[model samples]
Target: MTTKIRMTTPLVEMDGDEMTRIIWKMLKQTLIEPYVDLRTEYYDLGLEHRNETNDEVTVAAAHATRRLGVAVKCATVTPNAQRVEEYKLKEMWKSPNGTIRAILDGTVFRVPILVDCIEPFVRTWKKPITLARHAYGDIYRDVEMYIPGKGRAELVFTDGKGGETRLVVHDFEGSGVLLGMHNLDESIANFARACFRFALDMRQDLWFSTKDTISKKYDHRFKDIFAEIFESEYREKFEASRIEYFYTLIDDAVARAVRSEGGFIWACKNYDGDVMSDMVASAFGSLAMMSSVLVSPDGKYEYEAAHGTVTRHYYEHLKGNPTSTNPMATLFAWTGALRKRGELDGLADLAAFADRLERSSLRTIEEGVMTRDLGILSTHPSKKIVGSEEFLREIRLRLEKSGEAGRSCR
Candidate 1:
């Protein structure tokens, strides 16, 4: 047997739940362990374990990523009321991804894994569009109140100097609802820098959108920060890279995105990002085809799939049925982590192996061997749907055939 590639530092591996957890193992065993001397600081972020540890494991994993510089995570269940009963948890745990994002203070960048057989639904989209989502404060951290009867509501702030500022929110006629949302200036600055740096790194034009005219103060603040940072910090750098930085209203941006050939980074606020990311993923292909990476301001990275744990698929598997679940996003998550790890540790062979594995996986699909989700979307003339494990095995066959050179771990 040929040797496996080595790693200088261990990756923080966050295990997940449901069908994705099952596929995570299959990935390492079939596609990765065979080629690399896999080393990871494993943390079980699975629902049951999160329940047991009170989700402290998620926090530890995020800290580990900060220390180690890279991590690969699987999709975990963020329990609702139904899930709390199903898992029989003490309390509903917060989202593991959310915990990690807060600790790392990162921006999530999601890009579609394009393929020859599966073209984007949008006819003008010939290239992949990257979504640089600000992963902090907005509606996600909102405060709300359900007004039971007619009353006045106001926005009040007490400054550090003990001075008062106030604004009338609304005077309710009867029953109504109210929401308050905010973002910090520091966080906004960090988000802008992350987006600008990512755009420069990819050498792609950066497009930022917000309903500034409508939002006035709130959304305009985001626009101002991005513009301020761009003019003072990134203008020359962007000009040197020969890339443009454009800002438009959200509505106009959407129209431009649909009409233009896609190849740029779109910076969005928390809520807009959450909604538009799904829209972008669906337009390009399946959400399962999107690859997401959370990049911290300090350069820490956590790569994960944008999809959720396939609960329905897990139920089928529990019944001992062979299911054809797509593993592209999960597979790419590992490859993304590996490639980043190798780059940081100066392991060219390890990095090359990651690159090889990704090409092989994509090649397998292009050649018509894929899981059911992709098979349905694939327009390839000779497409064949395979079970989850078989889909990976097919990619493994290609990876080995590519003659990736690695040193023996034994």
Candidate 2:
């Protein structure tokens, strides 16, 4: 007789497009469905479906995730004007991620894959560096106006209570750039809370960086708010966990990140994260192996592949050709979301399954059975390169062998 296992909660599934969407379906059928009984509520968020639903599907999915507390997503197209014309979209809908993030009120965390054979540009990085980008207002979604002639550009901050006000003036003699950006006190506080939660979750030190020295009044407010939150709310917890929260200037933090060995959580403001995450991705290697997670301040979570739809690879796959697209990140998305779910439910066995799956993936790569991206980085001359399906098969075989070993020990 076989024992039955069940999931306590349903996982919100947002399906996507191109090469990754194809990989996402295959992973579920091959790796996940075989091991666990999942309660999955799926929403078709593919390009055509999104256009058909006018993106209501994405909003509904986000709401479901917020309600269910866990979501696993596949990479989807964030349609631009060109994409709209190419796909013949109805209206250029806002990014599905943007819509969901707005509703969920979360920050996105991106972590790179660290393999033994594929070396990172930052040699000191022994472990993966996870970056949490505060996906709120600053430079992105800002109001801007062109300052014609040499008129003074001023930033005025006014208190909602009384008639108290602060002003910053840019007195220019010639033509120059003038931009105004702002962050709400509420948003910044939530960002700080999320960063601290992520640090606590991962058991890593948290680092926050800003150019407070230059923009003392504006950026300094952010620094001071984060400091106050740390001292008041997180200090005791951080001390107990043996984790530290250090504040540094942006320039200094970048230098240190390059020199220091990786194993810390770095929280960045909106603009900085957008730029820095790309740099980190390049440093690590292929974007194909990068994983992303959205963690709300309220602790709701969603995980997905960080790379895009991989349109080029999808075309090859269309021709019935064996495409060597990397599926590690998508697999990690499932493991990460499930691990968090297991943790929340206090199901150690389920959590162990997630751990085993992750270990199996890494070990498969270590044993020389890998997709093309890592195949190019092969250390052994005898290592034979495999396609995506073949690589997945190799991992499955490794997992089965390990399971047999465990059973034998029992």
Q: Compare the candidates by TM-score and give the number of the best one.
A: 1
lDDT of 1 by residue, 248-364 (tens): 999999999999899999999977887888889989989889999999989999999999999999999999999998899999899999999999999999899989999888888
Worst 10 residues of 1 by lDDT: 401-410
lDDT values for all models? 0.91, 0.83
- In Å, residue 115's CA in model 2 sits off its true spot by 3.1
Residue pairs with backbone overlap in model 1: none
lDDT of model 2, residue 11: 88
Q: Model 2 over residues 266-331: C-alpha lDDT tens digits?
A: 889877986777778768877777778988878899998877888999999999888898899899
- Which stretches of model 2 miss by more than 4 angstroms? 1-4, 139-182, 201-203, 213-218, 236-243, 404-410
Q: What's each prediction's clash count? A: 0, 0
Candidate 1's displacement at residue 130, Å, is: 0.7
What does the lDDT read for residue 209 in candidate 2? 97
